[model samples]
Target: MWKTMILLVLVNVINGQCSCSKFTDESSCFAYGYCLFVNGVCVEQKCEAIPYQEKCKSPLCLWKDNKCLTFKAAESTCQTLLPQQCTEYQGCYYDYTNLKCQISNNCSKLEIDQCNGQLGNGNSCIVDPFNNKCQEMTDCKSLSTEFMCLSQFPFCLYQNSSCKPSSCNEINDSVSCSIMDQCQWNNNKCEIKNCQSIKFGYQCNGKTCGFDKDQCFSCIEQYGYQFFAGLISLLFIL
Candidate 1:
């Protein structure tokens, strides 16, 4: 009777062990995803869920732009584009209107200025020449100098220090040079003169002789000029 009881106890223990047993040997492991069953007992890595972090998106998508960053990192990024102010958040770049991160702005970087004149060095300043004020544009398109001409009131030195044509009507029709670097105020009218063309501009006859205006004006007709500039627009295309 005792021997019979022993056999029954062994069978129960085996059944219990087998209930959660997994494949331990290679052949058995192949049967399962990657489980291991040893001595009719399971020995495998338990599956657990990884907690999600609100601050970070899944690493799968890949960084089109790493604007979704930590506070410090976001600050640094904004400083590069907007020197005036920068706010921070997680999962997207700083937004001006809402002042929070919602989605990628696909930052349009405008005014990557060195701030040499008034904006300051290593800092960028968005220039609104129309209103004669400065704003800091961030996450913007490429920073470009617009050379649109604008009319103005007479005798008033423009923010750019040039006298605009007098307009009798309320509508101002000031026009600016296409090439900003080459345009400046000379006397009372706008003029085109710069390092690249200064040597050429000063001496119309050529540097071999002294500076000449008539020859220079003639040459300027080929290249564009400012205000009542040369007549290049009237003739040449290239």
Candidate 2:
């Protein structure tokens, strides 16, 4: 009986090691809790093998009790968190007046960093010039300054002393559009540059595009899952 139990344990360990080897790509391999892509091959992973706390945040590993461990879903409510922990928890903020962690929907209550960090469905939270409150920026016309307009590159443009939605074909000056990150001079006319043609990190902007690790990346592809996950968590609490 003891021999049979030992054989079963050995078989399970062997199967675990070999199972990850079947995955050929990084994305597919990393999707599984027990697998990791290493040296161009997919292999079995242990939470202890990961060194950094930030890197330990995937579905497979959790950083808790000052150690990396296999992830186990836990119900950590905002009301249960202490003042310091409340600030660390996503979508929850410490209310000093109320002296508790609370789910916040009012953008006006957020500070500059917190406001800017709130990204939802391609809309970014910005301080409204009229009310001096943080809110999702939806229209180009709301931007009153050239600096503000230009900051939303490829989406808004400063033209005729007003901020307006940009159109590559509407821009007549090849010299002016050429300097812009998303526009270029093409066939003697101003045209939007292809995102693939952007070689440097500084050149990528707009709602859908981003730069990471010296490579141009789609913002939707990169951050969509994380955004949705946070949204779902917020909804559950609400």
Candidate 3:
């Protein structure tokens, strides 16, 4: 009776251990759509049950033997792919709307006026210049620059029947300006310019520069050196 009970317990433990599907390599795990790695074991990865936001946009589908294959998010490695390719190749990408691989021709060309209608009410979309697909707009608060906002939200700076990039002058607070790396706010605008682009001018950011900008930065950097040097000289004198 004792031997039989021990045998049953061993069998139960083995069954519990073998319940999860195993893979020797990560590649095999991914190929089988099992991406979770736990305790040196590959386990099934559960995709979040998020609803699809829009119809699949296409023309960026992967080509094999001259045929465009629909993107399969689960089967394809999307995060590993370059973001630049997502724009350059048009639809040869896994559609973020549905999290699936899509063909380039699957997406229809959308205009600025039609973009908002593609997404849910109150949600907006941008018509990408490369593919003309109506991409859903990201929240305005999460964005830093007007150019990026315009790319994500086509209607960001609308005027004269056209959309334009937002300017740093639109920022209302010092914190927002600092977050944008515009250390100095002047004339109600983020006016610091790129120092390297102009002679003797200090670069405030990538595009703007200020004459006083370089002097201020130079003083700050030298302040530490000057302090250390003065301390050393005082020690020698003493």
**Best-fitting candidate, measured by lDDT?**
2
lDDT of 2 by residue, 39-64 (tens): 99877768887655655653356576
Cα RMSDs of all predictions?
33.1, 16.6, 24.8
Q: Distance from true position, residue 19, model 1, in Å?
A: 78
Q: Is candidate 2 or candidate 3 better by TM-score?
A: 2
Off by over 4 Å in 1: 1-76, 79-94, 100-179, 196-238
- Against the hidden true structure, what lDDT does model 2 obtain? 0.57
Please name the candidate that would achieve the greatest TM-score relative to the true structure.
Answer: 2
What does the lDDT read for residue 173 in candidate 3?
Answer: 58
What is the per-residue lDDT of model 1 for residues 1-238, given as tens digits with 9 covering 90 to 100?
Answer: 6545555443333222121232234443323322344555544323221121222222111112443332223334333433122222222333445443323222223222221111112123444555554443321222233322221123222334433332223223234332222344444555544223445533322211212222222222322234222222322332
> How would the candidate models be sorted by TM-score, starting from the highest?
2, 3, 1
Which 10-residue span in candidate 1 carries the lowest summed lDDT? 114-123
- How do all models score by TM-score? 0.19, 0.33, 0.25
**Top-down lDDT ranking:** 2, 3, 1
Off by over 4 Å in 2: 1-104, 109-114, 119-122, 139-147, 150-155, 160-162, 165-238
Q: What's the CA error at residue 19 for candidate 2, in Å?
A: 23
How far off is residue 75 in model 3, in Å? Answer: 13
For all candidates in order, the CA lDDT equals: 0.30, 0.57, 0.38
